[model samples]
Target: MLTGKKTIVFGERDEISATATSACLKAAGAEVVYENTACFV
Candidate 1:
């Protein structure tokens, strides 16, 4: 469980979008500071 932590997510565009991924992280008690869904591939 991540509590009082800061996390930055990038390019979570698989089955779940960036938002959903961030939400899941938040649910796990992580502080999602930034979420980027830009996939440059």
Candidate 2:
């Protein structure tokens, strides 16, 4: 389900939430390239 799209994430890395989200998004045909705890998106 990853489309391989450039993506950015900003949140507390307290759990696998971020990871899972990224994974799901990526699997959905998104090119995820970057990830951070703070991004002015």
Best by TM-score: 1
**Residue lDDT tens for model 2, 1-41:** 33545777545456445566777777788865766553334
Which parts of model 2 have CA positions greater than 4 angstroms off?
1-4, 14-16, 37-41
- The CA lDDT of each predicted structure is 0.78, 0.62
Q: Which segments of candidate 1 are over 4 A away from where they belong?
A: 12-15, 39-41
Q: How good is model 1 by TM-score? A: 0.64
Q: What is the C-alpha RMSD of each candidate to the true structure, in Å?
A: 2.2, 5.4
TM-score for each predicted model, relative to the true structure? 0.64, 0.48
